[model samples]
Target: MATHRLTELPADALKMIATIAGPVHDVEMVSAGYNSEIAARLHLDNGTVFVKGLRQDHPRVWTQQREADINAFTQGLAPALRWEIRKGGWDLLGFEDLGGRHADYSPGSPDLELVLQAMRYLTSATPPSGVELKTMPQRMIAHVTDPADVRFFEGSTLLHTDWKPDNVLIVDGQARLVDWAWASSGAAWIDPALWVIWLIASGHSAADAESLAALHPAWDITPVRHIDAFACAQQRLWESIARADRPDEWTHKLHAATQAWVEHRG
Candidate 1:
């Protein structure tokens, strides 16, 4: 698909949607992930649909397929994936829209519980074998693995490592989480800790995020050490991926957590 500015995409995209999905009443460009060129929620006379378009940026194809696969079994908790169309240069995806509310990260339990529930679902979903961790814990240790971490597979579960509020939709008291570009199958505890770290980086306080982490059954002492290491690795990964001008926030929280974890190891 040809890449265009959010406001400049060819009208054909919307025309095709209206033709198939029934006159699109409104099209709201929503999100763009790592290699994503388009992610939007389109409201139609019949209903609402979440649409994502990918161009030559091949990353979009991989993510579009992954998210659709995962959401197949995540009924209600994830937007219903409706259709996938691959035209010449574009990969398009349509999903049932989840309305009600977008995720907000202010200090509070309502939103916190919403995100945690999504993390819990991803970390617990059944997946393929030999999937102890996404990558060797050793390799990701400095960049993604947490401290005192061991990558041994007791189970294989698909994990939505990027389960933040921004990716979640809360509709009429129910919650639905979206975005699967970073989805992976790994240890039971890594995803929860990772999501918590991301929330903290986005501005949630350590005490607040820790409080939320505490709510997760995966936060037991046996895993906190590795989880903390996992958090630090995630921080470094975020910093590495952040724009040079962006202020790195997770680096500080990760440092503090690492130092504390190390002290306890002594």
Candidate 2:
């Protein structure tokens, strides 16, 4: 079973958002990202939107503004925004929740087509001018990876910094990429690289994930190579947060398994 911890927004903050959103029931915070909060379905009676608080320290927060701004200015591209409030460290972003189901993509599964279709559209669309990766390379590398090979991926006009099944949902056989916090100026390969890694982490066999990554010819390096380099970035992070001291037989074994896989690849 997957364990997900959620945080409830403060009372004052709740009312502050209700002022603009109208009626709301409750909200839950995700464990992965500090400032991201998802309001439940019941809370969205007439209409409700996903709310994300910005953090100055977070590299992707600024790109979120770019996403909102892009969606506001363009048509039929990104999730539509209702309003943006200038809060202290980060702004409050409220966007209409587009109805979608948690995407289930795996090796040899057609669900991947949904992700690919969306990838094609996003890479095809033009992003706003004067945009670059706001996240520091070192820190970004720390979270996922910063292989020397990744330098070849720079110079993309518009790219989603992060992409994974959890960050995407399917609606009417099409994929909608959410969680724009990682939007950046890198090449298109960066987004798909992130998605391939998620596939491997979520129980898909390594060979299968590698095949999926290779399907995208636009990417400079093969998905398998990039996945190997970046795999430690996320696995090490989980161990750090859980404060794992050693490898166990079952749960902490995840770290052990990751290590084994890394060694096998090397």
Candidate 3:
């Protein structure tokens, strides 16, 4: 989908944003995401604010609302939500501009350590009250070969399953996570397990990636049985996605990596 610049927003929508964000003197479209139709930084007199949205009629329109809801509970982990608006046939959200670079997880990089620190802190967080999020077990029920493997992921900790380098921002020597579309409630260990795949993709050996993740308390204490279950489940899930009618190159790469990780588990 083509991303829309702020100037492209209808006059009413621009007025609504200006009201909440101060007079917008400039607009810069952000090209990092795939789903957003309108993602930009509005330069107000006071400061820059990040905005992301999509057409109201889009099939995944509900994701914008979900991100807003999740943002309310993401105090320390993600940028704060400045406001949410549904105007001019669009549903948009404004967030505090976290001026930082995306984290790098390659071997010998310092950013990986900071990311682990953030993940450790995240494991201690309780989900905010009154918000509905899918449980990891619920989300993965269809992917695992054995029904019992689902129990391995049943827990109360909030999980950030997507660990691509693009989702983590490094600022002030700390790693701040972004993109809450896939946030779910699950065992704390599940997040570290998910990161292992990205770590490998970043050129770390499987053993080294496991070692880096082991620095987290959650990863250290994860039961061997549970780890085995999750490994097999992820392999099955990626296999199905990569083998689907017409899989893309990225999907095939991930499928192969997951398969290697599963074999490494043995």
Candidate 4:
């Protein structure tokens, strides 16, 4: 999903933003979002707020509500949500502008530690009561090679299943997770397992990536077979993604990395 400039927003949407955040002096369109149609830093008379939104009729528009509902639980590990605007056929969310660069996931990068710290913090979180969340098994059922492998993905811990570097920002020595669209309830070890693929894609070998993931306490307690099941599931997931679309370069890289990890597990 390509990001759109603030100017491209519906007139009523802009009016709604101005009404909520005061006059907008400038707009800096964000270039790093996949799920948002409008992602920008809106400079208002009062202050700046990072706003992201999608048309009300978009297939994934519900993600806006998901992010809004989950923000309370992500207080320290994620930027705070300030306000929400639903008007003119769009659902926009305003978030505190926590300025930071994406974390470096390459081998030996110091940012890896901060990323792990953020993951550790998330390991203790449980799904908020009354807020429906997809479980890992539900999300991965279609992709797992064997239906029985789905059992390995079940658990009650809250998870930020997407570990792409772009989703993690290193701010003042802390890694703040952004983009909660794929957040799920899952086995704690599954979060670390997901990170292994990103670490591998970012230049770590399978052994090194798994070693880094092992630093998380959950990884040590998870049975080896469970980890193997996840690796195999990831391989099948990426392969299906490739077959479904003309795989992008990064997707190819991830697919290869997933295959490597699966083979390493075997």
- The TM-scores of all predictions, comma-separated, are 0.76, 0.69, 0.91, 0.96
Q: Which ranking of candidates, highest lDDT first?
A: 4, 3, 1, 2
Give model 1's TM-score versus the native structure. Answer: 0.76
Q: What is candidate 4's local distance difference test score?
A: 0.88
- Backbone clash tally (model 1): 6
Between candidates 2 and 4, which one is better according to lDDT?
4
Worst 10 residues of 4 by lDDT: 1-10
lDDT per residue, candidate 3, 96-151, as tens digits? 99989999888999998899989998988876667778899998899888898899
Global lDDT scores for all candidate models: 0.61, 0.57, 0.82, 0.88
lDDT tens digits, residues 1-266, model 4? 22343446556777899988889888888877577988888888778899999989988888999999999998998789999988778899999999999999987899999988999999889999877789999988987778988998889999988888889999999999999988899899998999999999999999999999999999999999888888988998888776764566778888999999998887
Per-residue CA lDDT of candidate 1, range 65-91, in tens? 666666665665777888876665666
Clash numbers, per candidate: 6, 0, 0, 0
CA error at residue 14 for candidate 2, angstroms: 2.6
Q: Which of the numbered candidates is closest to the native, going by highest TM-score?
A: 4
Q: Residue 13 error for model 4, in Å?
A: 2.2
On lDDT, the candidate that comes out on top is 4
Q: Give the worst 10-residue stretch by lDDT in candidate 3.
A: 1-10
Which regions of candidate 1 deviate over 4 angstroms? Answer: 1-5, 31-35, 128-155, 243-266
Model 2: per-residue Cα lDDT at residue 39: 31
lDDT at residue 23 of model 2 (Cα atoms): 72
Off by over 4 Å in 2: 1-6, 25-45, 54-67, 70-77, 87-90, 135-150, 220-266
